[model samples]
Target: MGGSFKTQREVNGLFELTDSARNNLKNNAYYNDDLAPTKLDERTWGTYHIAALWVGMSVCIPTYMMASGLMAQGLSWWQAILNIALGNLIVLIPMQLNSHAGTKYGIPYPVFARLSFGIKGAHIASIARAIVAAGWFGIQTWIGGGAINAALSIVSPAWGAWSAGIWVSFFAFWALNVWIAHKGPDAIKFMESWGAPILGVLSLSLMIWAVTAVTQMGGSVGDILNLPATYAPGGFWKIFLPGLTANIAFWATLALNIPDFSRYAKTQKDQFMGQLLGLPTTMAAFAFVGVFVTGATSIVYGEFLWDPVAVVANIGSPIAGLLGALGIAVATLTTNIAANVVAPANGISNLNPQKITYGMGAIITGVFGVVMMPWKLMETAGAYLFDWLGTYGLFLGPLAGMYVADYYIFRKKTLDLDDLFKGEESRYWYKNGINDKAIWTWVIAGIFPVLGKMVPALSFFSDNGWLIGFVVAMIVYPVLMKNDTSSLITPEEEEAMNEKVTG
Candidate 1:
């Protein structure tokens, strides 16, 4: 009887172990098994590297285009800036919360997802994220190709030849990014360290040139700043709220996966400092520079222009155009590797935790990127692609809400960290490695928001669908899963789970 009790306890603990615990026990075979876990030298990534990533990611053509959109929406530059800052602040909250877990556990995002979604069901979330990443990868590559092509046009008016050359350059760089990603996390770390700073220097140089040109052309800074708003206000709720929600959702993809990077931090302090330095200070500064340069461009050209590539092309200097294209290409590659590659890698790894390694995940994601034909979608759909992706927030919002509610409200910050890894017949093995109640609540909560985004009549709430999904999940997941404590492992069981993880 005693032996049977001990065996049962062990089995229960295994079933309850969280995904990270499982990875630790399984020697991280699910992802990057060939690469031994290297205790991240946290000091290697200082505030500067963290800051640079935000700079590189945020201070680009897309950001400038988005800022232009805000300006077009009739918001004063100051108002637009304020709105973006607030939206980014909202994004930072979840990122910080998720990062805490990552810094503590040193696990990637997919592994972490298992804690909330179940080892098996986690794949659904992972695949969704991967799809998004793959799509962006192709889109960005295509955009970068266009920029390169534009620059080439100045050098040689032979349009077709230059276009072909531009695509070739884009693919070459794209292939290089893939190779770097395959070299594993270290390559990413190195790129993040250098890419942002280089891009910053280039951006600042452009800004300086623009400002100098404006001054030389007898335009005052005040004149430059007072550019007229282009967009008419539909209503406060329609305009302001939509902009706010779009800004938040714009960051949802990265915000959701912050833990993947944060887990490498040596300590929670490192994570906190990184976020503080990275998001508000670095990202805001980049945006400010973007606006400033863009404003100068408008002053010089007698029209509001948002795309940096367009701004450079309008500079009427072939050299400047070429340099601008080069900078954008480099920045795109950096973001593509860091954000796009990792998100999918985590997703694929989660799908078959025992079979897919990190390298395998990257290859799979890359293949998906090819199949998705992201470039064609971007060309056809344009900005609507971004708006369409807002529906994903319905699913992600609920997932995030449930995770947060489970950790803070229901579980009271306590976690079993064991049963997450166990096989069938284990407590968390609810109907074959899934929590149906959680799933049902998630699907239910996600539907209305998606409907709001999709259906014209229901569009009033379209902008705030993410928030709706979040609120619904927060309310429903706990209520539905209540007293179903079998899905969770106990603290004593966590010890046994830890032994397996550390073994």
Candidate 2:
């Protein structure tokens, strides 16, 4: 939570935003629970637990759908898996870099952004990051609804065909997401820890089922394993390059907002080892399952089945389909709320912390999820794969780059927590309340990418847009803010400031 709105904001030369009494409240931005530093008592998560978080998020329908979409575009199984693995590993660098701020300083991503983007200007990045999360929330909700509809068919075929039934299923799953998020991070952690293993086991079972179905159709296992590429060698790299970029975009949202989760780390080793052990391997392995099953579909059904929900429905037994749908629905639910709802919810709540609680932030995310009309995207999920995921990465990458350069280069891994909360004028206050340099840097870096996305002839910029933006921001921001020492609050001053107020 931030400062209150009832009082007149005081300005005492260099410390208008640092009023101990007036801004003590979490009013101006993020929720008190979200923005504040983690207390010694609440920092109990360890290496395995953090790994479980990634595992739970990684082994879900969207992760599978991404790989399957790549295969649909004509890449072989190895090509698709390689891209996912490589992308995850590349994203891990910035993920770890951003996580350092949270683990060391106990601040969320939005707060961390304030260091580079100014206290208020950070909203630009925060909200931009949230848009992707909102998009994800809608996509996952749509997937869950499809899963629910498939499960419902086992009960009554008529119930599954109604559009009203689909809406009801969507809302019900939406309600489940809201309920868990309302329960807070503890409930989320519990779900991730337990849900990940269950989903992993079920994926193996799904593989077995697919292989059996293919064999029963008199198809050889060798054909599925050695599924030929539909793309010519030259054509494969054309799609593979953008496909790789899309894969990076898959978890790029998390790479930027990771501090939200990393803030809970008990030790630096916990975050480091956990993400290293969990991210790429889980994505590659789960994606392999999707690749194999989709290939099996080609053998058994004479066409590819990219949608996992449809794969479950086509299992040829009502009972088996029901079981698969239930598993998928549960997996999607876990992934949706954990991966999609939490970050944006925190970001919106950060905009006005005093009034908007975490639950309200979550509600905001849910409402936008509906407004995005994710069902339309689902109808041709493959077509939007590059457009939806790769495009967002263009901006998010710059935000991540600025944070890394700001924290490691300009600030030297040090920050004044007291200065982060204030509003008057400090080193972080570049102009009024916004860090114009950081804002301009991000904007300039992202322009061509956004343009490239819109203009077909500039596809080179589109394919490498995120990486280009990241490099430009990384180089530009530090050069612009080189002489600033406003954030250089000494440790003793920090202690005195903390002593005057509550943590």
Candidate 3:
């Protein structure tokens, strides 16, 4: 009798433990307990890292192309410059706020999504974000490959094999990136630290060269400054609003995933200062210099040249052109690794917390980059995909809303951390670890904004999808999930939950 009673108690404990584990898993579906979170080291990064991030982000082909496009839209040069500046300011706010969690928990953005989106739903968002990142990886690779081809042609006329050389160079750089990324976060951080500074110096050098050349040609700096007005229209607000919105969306991926990087910071202050110093100031400086160089190109070349690589090629000096090409390639690679590789890797890792390791995540992400053939996407689709992808802001908006609402409005920012890991019976395991109200709200709210981008009649909302999606999600999520009380967890229950997260 005694033996049988002991056996029964053991069986009961096992069943209860399994049930608890299932609930925890459902609640924290998006996070991976297996991956060790990064602890920030205050000494390693300071204002400079932040500044370099902006330099790397701003001094890219897409940003310049967008600035030029805005100019072509009939806004004056000053108007456009102001627009870019103001736009960057707006993007900085949310980034700073979101980065706090990363610094505190050392978890990436997709993991953070579990606070609001439920575990599984976060994957949906992660996949969307990853798809966009993969596309960008391919596009940047293509651009870098072209630069290699151009440099090779100059070095040896026999290397004039354009298509073959371009693809070859593309694969070479792609392979290098794969290697770097495979080394994990430390490698990515080291590259960002060193590569960012070098790229900044090169960009500044290009600007100086352009200015000096313009002055020697008997042209005043004023002439170059005056060019943007002839191209774009309206004043600061008109240009500023669209430019600001577009840049915010363009930079949204970085802002949203900042936790991925911030998790490495030593303290919240380190993360905060890094964001304040890095994103806004650096982005502004890059924009200023970019506009200055492109303006000089307009005056000297007699036509506007927005692509930095093209600007360097037009300089007519072999050495200078080669240096410029190399700089752009380096800059693009830095971003590809930091922004493109890291976020998606975390996203995929979250999907199967037990099965997908960080190294595996990196490999899978790189493979997707190849399969997507980003070069084909950019060359064939043009800016249409960017516009289409901008619609993602709609989903992000609601997702963010749910996060802020759950933490601040509903749960009061005090999460039952243990419940996050428990299985089905977990208060968080709403309907088999899925939160239908949040998911449905996100889908419905995202549709209109996406349609706005695809349909010409709805293009008016294209540039402002972030705002639109945010507003809709904010209203819809709360209302839909109002009667659903499963998300609520008491303070005492939360404490009894787990003190440490277990894989």
Candidate 4:
């Protein structure tokens, strides 16, 4: 009993709630042990665990694709690595700022969103996040399915020659992914911790293989260091700015939903050290592997290869090809479950807490994955690079800016947690369970970056979408809330709260 906080017994007959916080909220779709604010006793993750989570996620096909995809577009090996480093380093600032709210308050990102976006307005942002995660799930599934089919073909080439085998493999891999995601957060945590060391060892082995293969082909190692760019059709700033935007956006999903994991941190130091060690270093190291391996493939096979699955498929030796492809499949499995499924599941659950559980949310994502047919988006260079990554940066950019500005600037890093779950008459329920100001702020900031992408002449806007959107929200949000913090608790409310706690 943290004051006379209202928990709805019923909201427009949506579901029965009660002043009894435990009995009312626990089984409701909105209330889960996973989604609830973490009590002190629940914070258990250490720096090592956090670091491993990053490594497991980083040593995957997307990280490989992120680097290779950039090089395939026009970046030098060094340029691609540099951008990855810089994008990740810059993104780390917002990620850390967002993580602090979670680590201190023990709330997941959706709950965190309530402060910035209003109680129900947060759902709008939450669903946007879920959409991105679902799209990624499908893309990663296609990759894993392709790899599995390759391995199966090595075992039985004639069967692999048929399209039926690929379809079968795709369905099989999808089912596996759904199973892991459905098992819930604990399974994801276990996979990240247990799978990281294995994947890291595999990454080193792949690098060693690439270097040895290139050497045998009489390819100078120096060739990779100085490969000429094939497609820099635009000026450097034009190319670099847009390319850098894509890089920042690559992990932007995690930037928003990191609270899903960081809330489990045993200490802020652990989360900081773990992310500090994990993100840039692992991304840089993995990008290096991607650049080297793709370059080595060009020398050996006389064609640039972007997809690691495609590279492994043509390895020629049945044993090496099958094992390498299987390794990639496993890596994708770890990444899809950890990176794609968790955020969206939590987000979808946040939308209708009485109806959707994490398991149901995960299944909904799988259905969307099937409907989206994400393989088409990955079929070409432009589709993979700009269409997916650049476009997502448009909307997500505003989100990043809004969350950072709201927490750091407006509220001054302070929040009222008990009011967060209160159904009605809560200060957060500004207008009909939504904050029109926050909704409009997101819309205004979101429009510019998205417009940049649509208008062919304003490519510069697209190039700098996330950066601009973020800056706009940071500046605009403070102005909107400056004279109107009726939403915030006044000194009198704090005194009353204190009396309730003390008395």
Per-prediction TM-score: 0.85, 0.91, 0.84, 0.92
lDDT of 2 by residue, 50-121 (tens): 898888899999888888888888888888899889988988989998898787766788778888888788
lDDT of 1 by residue, 95-171 (tens): 77766655554456665666666667667767877887877676666667667767677677886365467667567
* Regions of candidate 3 where Cα sits further than 4 Å from its true position: 1-61, 230-242, 376-391, 495-503
**Candidate 3 to truth, TM:** 0.84
Q: Write the per-residue lDDT of candidate 3 for residues 95-136, one digit (tens) a residue.
A: 776776666555567766765666566677777778767766
How badly does each model clash, as a count of residue pairs?
12, 11, 26, 4
Model 1 misplaced regions, further than 4 Å: 1-56, 159-166, 233-237, 370-389, 416-418, 425-427, 494-503
**Residues 317-416 of candidate 4: C-alpha lDDT, one tens digit per residue:** 8898888888888878888899899888888888878777889999999988877788888897568878888889878877888888888888876566
Q: Rate the local accuracy (lDDT) of all candidates.
A: 0.64, 0.79, 0.64, 0.79
Q: Which 10-residue span in candidate 4 carries the lowest summed lDDT?
A: 8-17
TM-score, cand. 4: 0.92
Worst 10 residues of 1 by lDDT: 1-10
